[model samples]
Target: MLNRKSFGFDWGQFITGILFLIAAFVVMRYPLATLKTVTFIFAVVAIIRGIAILAGYSTLRQLTGKLAWVSLLMGIFDLVIGV
Candidate 1:
């Protein structure tokens, strides 16, 4: 009696849960890699955020006055931090 729209099961969450469980097992099996693994994940996140900020520069171009300069500075800072 479960309708597709009302079924509270979110497929994406289910898949993510499974993946997280697998990751936990892997981390447990290789305790020494825990630090390196976490660092690499954070690095990737930072790099992606930096790229997003850089891309927003184009949108800021339409704005006037000091806003443009502020956007440019923020984008550059994000890129430097990521690198």
Candidate 2:
């Protein structure tokens, strides 16, 4: 017989997802006041995403080979847009 373990819920991911939803609601409710804040948040997220992609370039390249360049380009584009 094989021992199987059930996967547990990720509390951190759940909490962060909930927080993102609340933030979206707040932005929708008060667009004018939150416009700048929302943009800043977006820029930060883009920058972080770009960094993560670049950091994982090696693994991604191994997985996708020729297609990895597209991901790299996307990361660069994101970094540029974020800045």
Best by lDDT: 2
The TM-score, computed over Cα atoms with residue i paired to residue i, of candidate 2 is: 0.66
What tens-digit string does per-residue lDDT give for candidate 2 at 1-83? 22648656755345546656766987989887687767776676677767777887888899779989988998899899889
Worst 10 residues of 1 by lDDT: 7-16
Best by TM-score: 2
Steric clash pairs (candidate 2): none
Candidate 1's error at 20, in angstroms? 10
Model 1's TM-score against the true structure: 0.49
**lDDT (10s digit) by residue, model 1, range 38-72:** 55544554555556656766765664555777777
TM-scores, one per candidate: 0.49, 0.66
* Model 2 vs truth, CA RMSD: 5.6
Off by over 4 Å in 1: 1-30
The lDDT for every candidate, in the order shown, is 0.62, 0.74
